[model samples]
Target chain A: MSLLEVKNLCVSFSAKGKEFAVLDNVELSVEQGSIMGIAGVSGAGKTTLLRTLNLLQRPASGKIAFDGVDIMSVSQEELRVLRRRIGVIFQSYNLFRNKTVARNIAFPVIIEGVNKKKALEKAREIAEELELIHRLGSYPSQLSGGEQQRVSIARALITNPRMILLDEPTSALDPFLTSRILRLVKRVNSVHGVTVIIVTHDMSVIKRVCDQIAYLEKGKMVFCGPTHDYFSEYYLSVSHDDHAAEQLEKAKKILAENGGNKLVRLVFWGEAAGEPILWKCSKGLDVSVNILYGEIEEFKHGPFGTLLVATCGKDSAEFLRRLSGNVYKMEVLT
Target chain B: MISELTRATLESLYMIFASGLLSILLGMPLGIILYTCAGSKRLASVYRVMDVSVNIFRSVPFIILILLLIPVTRRVTGTIIGPNAAIFNLTVAAVPFFGRLTENALNTLPRGVSDSAQAMGVTYRQFVFMVLVPETLPDHILNASVLLINLVTYTAIAGAVGAGGLGQLAINYGYYRFQWNVVLYSVIILVLISQGIQLLGTSLSRMLRK
Candidate 1:
């Protein structure tokens, strides 16, 4: 079921007497109890969209229905109540430097008028769960970046929010810390049934934890679907191969130098991912195939692979047609 | 001479304590107002009025301010030539001074602090008292110490106009009567007090640092 529905969402910022849309007529829907990753390059309005989701930044015009209520039209008092149900964690952790770890975790409950002693107790329990009990008395500055991030997560979770929005939560952490945070996020989602909407530029993060993915480019959501589908369609761009673009460039060079050779990019997911579809197609169509580059990675749902191949034969066109029908996606590079 | 010096010192301390306390109490809210209003679209006009008012009052020379406030001082305290009347003037001047200082202290906090607080559903009042004020307490203390030291100097200026403190003693006996030794003693005491407040503020601020 759709837990949050955003339609025709428009957000703009005016600077130096000029106005520009940060998010223009964007549309999205997040299913209940699912992890949705919003991915985009910097200045692509990913963060703006996340901020708009929690009503931290009001849009210029749009309809945002959260948990079946029109949040944009709610009164200030009602808005506050609605915000409490949705937790937000920032890129920098945003822990209270002045407060101890325990106090920082307990702050939301205290704001809700819970007794101070009870709030502290609740904070201690959450700190324990997040493996931060030993650092409870320390301030945010004293803790490591990962510890601070956990304290922030503990704070968000202590409120028992139905949904949590994390903005680049692991961008600053090392790989080991990043995995730990992702594990905690997954545990929170499954164990507590909390819906998660995370905005990140890292595709690996999306592959590790997100069930669905949304791709934004220049303030417009260009793709939104299951995680596997996004990878299949935009494999070259989103591949963990930092050299995907460079490799593609090199492939194009080779294709141009080797006359009469065809360069094709193929994406395979699900059942086709495990089969030798490329080899079969080459043999059946009587084409010579040279594998240029390939990557097979496991996503949350299953395995997805992208392969770039160079083919040379009289029946290259027939080979391409057969491969296109077998693979999830096929595109001509050169 | 010893007894008179003691009396002047006590009177100076009294005026400083009363005016400094009043300034902090009043100025803190003013500073919060300035910080909060500056960020609020609905309160843009309120921010402008306050910003201009603080600038206007801050620009007027302190000595000139005392003179200009004489009639108003008399209206409040029913006397315009003693420590009590000077306190009314001192507090009026120092309130805006400290208010601006508080605003600067609050501004030094990372923007994320307040943004996180708001995301957690805190009201504006709660944000100021619970998050903004506490987060900036160390800076606030340092700012307050600076204000208190300024207050000490202003008190001496007030004493020049018969406000009855160390300044009056120094001006009457040393400046007018040419008693250099008297001036030396008062100067030494003023320096001691200023250093003392600075030491206290620095220590307190350090202790509060997380």
Candidate 2:
């Protein structure tokens, strides 16, 4: 069953005397013990959609059900109690500058009337998990951007929220820190069985943690499914790097040989991208070679991508002998 | 000479202290109300009415205001001319001035701070006490110092209505009696006092700054 459900959500804003509808009937769901990804580019209303999940930005019209309770129908006093169950992290970190890291993390709990000692203890517990225990007494101004974001995550998670909404929690973070925070998020979900909905442009964030991924385009959800399926379908479209295209074509032919029509085009990079695939393929003659379309380019991780080519050409034996195990392949589209 | 100088300084200080404290009490909240009520987009018409009232009061010169308020001052305090009467008029004058100063101070704060507080479920009263007050503290202190300095000068002008202070001392014992020594000394003291306040205020504000 879905722990949090947003159905028929719409959001609009008024600017310069004209109202513009930003979110158009977006719907999403997150099950308990799952990390759900809402993947979108900037200005795709990803933040607006995330804000609607907790009614931070009240939708123009929608139904948000949390564990079967329609949050929209609750009174203001009751909604505060409901909000306590839903923690939210922002892209900006949003740490209160006047407070120390521990106090900042403990604010939501303190607001809920948790005693100072208890709130600090809870904050400390989450801080240790996020690896922010050492800086609990430091103020937000004293920490780096990444450290502040970790404190924000610790703050949100300290509430023991049934479900948490993370809005680009790592966008402001450096790559190393981003990976660390995402790992912590996964740990929170798996170890604690808490539902997590992360809105982010980082595909690795989805791949590393998310159980399901939903793609949002211009306020509309275009795709929603398991992370592996999301990677199979949409991940390729995002990695239009020339090298990724070459590797993708090769994998297609190999997967198709095994009757794997629904294939996941995994792009390799660094040592993985340059692996000796053709050398291994020399022994397998049944896998013919056909390079229909191939592109290669340098990336931060080196050349990687789709090799959208058929593996069954007349010179297939020669092709297989020439480029043998050095290549990967998947089936051509029917 | 030192004893007389000390007594004169103490009297001047007393006049300034009494007027400044009274003005703050009367003006700060009025300024807050004027700014908050009028500054609101939802209450634009009410804001306009308040704006007109403040403008009318502010446009009148302090000396003229003191003269005009003599009857009201007499009715309120049973005295037409004295340090007490001057305190009443000076406070009345400072209200509109500080009201404008406070309005500008509040305007300098980031709109995000206010919106964030509201979104966090803070009530209007708590917004004022917690968010708005903290964000505007630096500006508020600066304006209050400026208002105190202005009140010091206003109290001097109150001497024209038979009020007693350094201004009266200068006119009564120095200018009228041709004791230029007393007038020169009083003028020097006033300048030194105002300069001290400005310096103290600036340093204190700098110390308070993050």
Best by DockQ: 1
In order, what is each prediction's RMSD in angstroms?
A: 3.0, 6.6
Model 1 bad stretches (over 4 Å)? A236-265, A276-292, A308-327, A330-334
- TM-score versus the correct structure, for each prediction: 0.92, 0.77
Query: In model 1, what is the error at residue A308, expressed in angstroms?
Result: 4.2
Q: Over the stretch B75-163, how does candidate 2's per-residue lDDT look in tens digits? A: 99899676777778888888888888877877765653443343344545655665566666767778778987887787778765577
Q: List the residue pairs that clash in candidate 1.
A: none
Candidate 2 docking quality: incorrect, acceptable, medium or high: incorrect
- Where does model 2 exceed 4 Å of error? A67-69, A115-137, A235-287, A290-309, A313-331, B1-8, B22-52, B103-120, B173-178
Taking the tens digit of each residue's C-alpha lDDT, what string does model 1 give over B173-206?
Answer: 9999999888999989999999999999999999
Model 1 chain B: lowest-lDDT 10 consecutive positions: B109-118
Winning candidate number (TM-score): 1
